[model samples]
Target chain A: MKKHLTIALDAMGGDQAPAVVVHGAHLARERYPDVHFVFFGRSDDVQPLLDAAPLLKKVSRFVHTDDVVQAEDKPGKALRRSRQSSMALAIESVKAGECDVAVSAGNTGALMALAKFILRTLPSIDRPALASLLPTYKGECVMLDLGANVECDASNLVEFSVMGAAFARTVLGLQRPRVGLLNIGVEELKGNEEVKEAAEILRTSDLPMEFCGFIEGNMIGAGETDVVVTDGFTGNVALKAVEGTAQLIGRLVGDAFRSSWRARLGYLLARRGMNGLRDHLDPNHHNGAVMLGLNGLVVKSHGGATVEGYATAIGVAIDMAHHNLIHLITKDLGGVAMDRQESEPLTLETDKQAESKSA
Target chain B: MKKHLTIALDAMGGDQAPAVVVHGAHLARERYPDVHFVFFGRSDDVQPLLDAAPLLKKVSRFVHTDDVVQAEDKPGKALRRSRQSSMALAIESVKAGECDVAVSAGNTGALMALAKFILRTLPSIDRPALASLLPTYKGECVMLDLGANVECDASNLVEFSVMGAAFARTVLGLQRPRVGLLNIGVEELKGNEEVKEAAEILRTSDLPMEFCGFIEGNMIGAGETDVVVTDGFTGNVALKAVEGTAQLIGRLVGDAFRSSWRARLGYLLARRGMNGLRDHLDPNHHNGAVMLGLNGLVVKSHGGATVEGYATAIGVAIDMAHHNLIHLITKDLGGVAMDRQESEPLTLETDKQAESKSA
Candidate 1:
């Protein structure tokens, strides 16, 4: 493995910004000591925390920026006032190749917006997508277009399949990931025209992935495919619903154990095993959601992520950098344009980072 | 409470067919003594089962129909071969008012098509939606457009909200159920044009429901609202994904208990409380999915549902009939058309029963 990877940090972002950023970086450093971080935030706000953790300061560089992107800012507004902001500067460093990757605990739309404008998408990619790792019964699967582009055409779906497959190869270390389109049904003739057309194109294309025809939402957690491809609208809803179900189950489990004294005694005896189950369901275990298909790697950590969760997000950035994610994406997109050229040329208007980000 | 109610059953429908149908009806009868059943299936297939359960046969009438609707048949194909089919006859009885409501453990698309053809929709409803009860943390909530319409407009969404609200009122016994428009984000200006426009219309229109502005997929299981309204495509994916998550958590919990002897012992101790949790997660508890906006009530049960599951489905139909679902839906949709006229005339072409059922 290549050593000495420097990650650009959007220190003044997220719900608990500078402290979580610095603390998360320190925790990640313990796991991968050779890694370096360049923090972009107001020095006064970030430096005091970094100073408290002496070892983290030794290998890190802090670049002061007075402006922090507000969580509520629309993508267009965030970009219009983007220059010299911590998020902008952090992304710029990666554009300049000063950092191998960028990690941010920030608003998703703002991060996607900045990442798209600063780094741009790969040559073959029509629209870059947001991808995340979800824990399945067997292991993990990569699901894409979480919320970046709500409306996608056949070309966009096809592109997502390619990007998703490549990310699975890089992060999950799968050689030929099984890529399936997310649809209402697995029937050959199911879904809208775009989904069917995309499946048809994928069926014939020589993409560097196993093209599973169609997989339903229930199959996502059953480990039916290594990578799931879909429009952001369906993908986003499915993901959040899965999360909601997890929460519902967790609460139910807790309530069940606490309902009576006998159950409480059993819970005590099964505490070790139950803890393992909790570990499986923790958001920290699956913290990072990568904005794929960009020229540079950009990983978005949850805004409410704790030190451990943010550190896991950093680990994702490190993995992407170590595994040559950009090159992998480029390689996957290589054969896509050749097989299918008859579809309508893609439009850029529908692929906004956020709903009100038209400007 | 009104006790005497007649329900039409497509006895030859579902994977377990006449056996599950007969058993489920008997189970429901034990709970509800004054109920009557009209069995629409081959008497030879259903007769033996009814003979085994004498009390069921006492309150039921059998109408022989040799033809059975296959699960794989497209909606249009099913309709083309509709005459004397068990599903068709069962729905036709509802149309003819021989039964208070129709319950079928058949394919959804086929049931929706036959229901729409024979019963027709109410004057105010442009398209009927597939609605189901989902198990949330606190209790249950109604979710609509499970897979009836792939593409929905503002008018259709507003219609769904109205229908879903009425159904919640009928089944859940809430006078004015809190209705939420399912979207990717809960922000004011998130999701697509249809969702935004629907929110605007519902905000001003005198719909007979509490218009909770927007709810995310994650909040569905958290009991954010009593009714969730969305396009069929997203609703289908979200519901199935939630089911998948439940399966995953169940498997994980099972594995955790089996990992060691101590856990196995603990499992024995916690068996009672754990069983309650299992009941909460059981598919049988949330079995029925109603096809709303029709002139008469139509309830679709899971094809693979066991006796208890189909009983729950029957229970849903009983509730609908008892509370006058059609009247409630008509009242809920009463003031919607007057306030919104700017949207393009509702298109019947986009609202398909199934993907390949455009015919």
Candidate 2:
């Protein structure tokens, strides 16, 4: 048998789970002939779809788990209680070295909790962060801690900055990714104390990276920064805003296309151009959010993701596995074992130093 | 000699200060003939521009202050040191009741600090927030805490919610605005403990408003909610993301419109339609960030704002002054003077409760 990239996919997560998840796995199986998928969930729920797909029947395996972690359940509580959930099983596959990567479209909070609880953070890593690839007008930018650790301090932000840069290098094909500290203003002293403190440490820290000072929100999609580091709270909010704005634009185009026959004809005339634009704006095309700094590779898909979205997510998992991104992040960011103090803890005095100089 | 809407303009503020600020003031005077502006800066700087426009000389007054605050100056220090800065003088005009509104595109932090120190928050309001009317595909949404009070707790968010809703109702013509908590997920448990806790308070608080529970980033421009409340950090990030994405889309469209002869021909054919869309997406038209929960009306404009943007900001200030938003916030939400005990500080237990009930 040829060596295959085995991926354990949690099939019972996400808003359209089992159906879209199973379909996505099948679609991915066709695209990547060498990928072997282990679908974890209730066998009864997944069997009908697997039986329907000849390709899935050929290359996929089933790891039965009875519990389904509802999106509504508290993340910590759900992770602890739903021990047999598909998400937990999928992560376990990576922990047990049964699969090269784990993919899920389940409750993101639960996935974060379970993955952190089971696989744990890499040594020296303070916390695991979710890094999402944003398709900007210039090209693509990596936005990290999309919705992971919300209440992060200066040190957590610094760690995130290093980890985000590493991910950008490994996945986004940037050699020395220009890391930007996302703030309201582009000036050096523009953000809250946490951001200000982080900026100071990032400036002087002898990390093998490029620190591109501060970047504001408007520059996020301008392709000014390759890796934008922010706490999960702000990052998640910004990601949603971009997503919301894109969808809003889509709706506006739709409305304009339907207003009048001239408009409709105009819409038909512009359909090709609009489609080209849609090709870039579509969320499904940019499907995966990688949980970085984790010991095991875990990729989360949008909970409302369709089959195509899942396929895109699976592709992300394959890329991460192929490049061994987690291993690289571990090696590059001090093996994730360094204590908080060792990982360049920024002090108020250093921040004051930058402030004084800038002033 | 007709009574005019008097605005104190900070001529020495912003990147293109003295030039763009002077030009913006001239345009506002030309556009709004009954509008009178008091230019705050050196008389020498104003006289040269005033010489060019005889109409500006007729409609404007000058406050000669030599000091100017640089964008990089620390807010607290700048607020103290730049006592005679143009922006400070403009703010003082409003405090002295010499002008209906104070408008500046200068150092935002400094402006905010000065406004708070001089004018203060409304009775019972803990912190003042910057709120703006954001252009959406549907129409517009009111977003609060755009760049004020970055480090906030749940009580601050609740106040933002109240203030944002009132602004939306007063400015955007929304009745009983549906207040949405901007968070990582629609599920209540999906954000930080602060968000979760805020969700619970918003649910039970007697704000005489329509509470739409939780909303994520992408929902803002989708008209999912009329008023979206978040902390300064997240709000600023989200607002900037929208601004950046819009610029990106504009650039892409501009490129496509100029790509080739055939595409250029297509662009010509769709010029009218494209123009309408472009006008709809223009950020300048969405001018002004209202500093909500303040004791007086304070508006912040883009430091790089053109004449039209400043004019629109002045118009918004007129509307704010006309409606007495400050008084409404104080009367309805018990602005900054409330006892700390009654402020209802957020706790982990409330976060857990909100998560279990709604998530």
Please tell me which predicted candidate would have the highest lDDT against the true structure.
1
| Top DockQ hit | 1
Per-residue lDDT for A1-359 in model 2, tens only?
Answer: 22778999998998888999999988888899988999999989898888999878789898888998998778878767987888898999999989988999988778888999999888767677889888887778888888787667777788888888887876777788899999878777567767887888788776657889888899988999889999988988898888778777766656655655666655555556666777777788888999888888999999988899899999888888877887677666663333466434344554565477346
Q: TM-score of predicted model 2?
A: 0.85
Q: For candidate 1 chain A, which ten residues in a row score worst on lDDT?
A: A344-353
Model 2, C-alpha of B100: deviation from truth (Å): 1.9
lDDT of each: 0.89, 0.80
On residues A247-281, what C-alpha lDDT tens digit does candidate 1 reach at each position? Answer: 99999898888888888888888889999989988
DockQ of 1: 0.65
Clash counts for the predictions, in order: 0, 19
| Residue ranges of candidate 1 with Cα displaced over 4 Å | A1-3, A337-359, B1-3, B337-359
Candidate 2 ranges with C-alpha deviation above 4 Å: A15-19, A42-56, A64-67, A70-77, A204-208, A335-359, B1-5, B11-36, B41-81, B120-123, B173-175, B196-205, B335-359
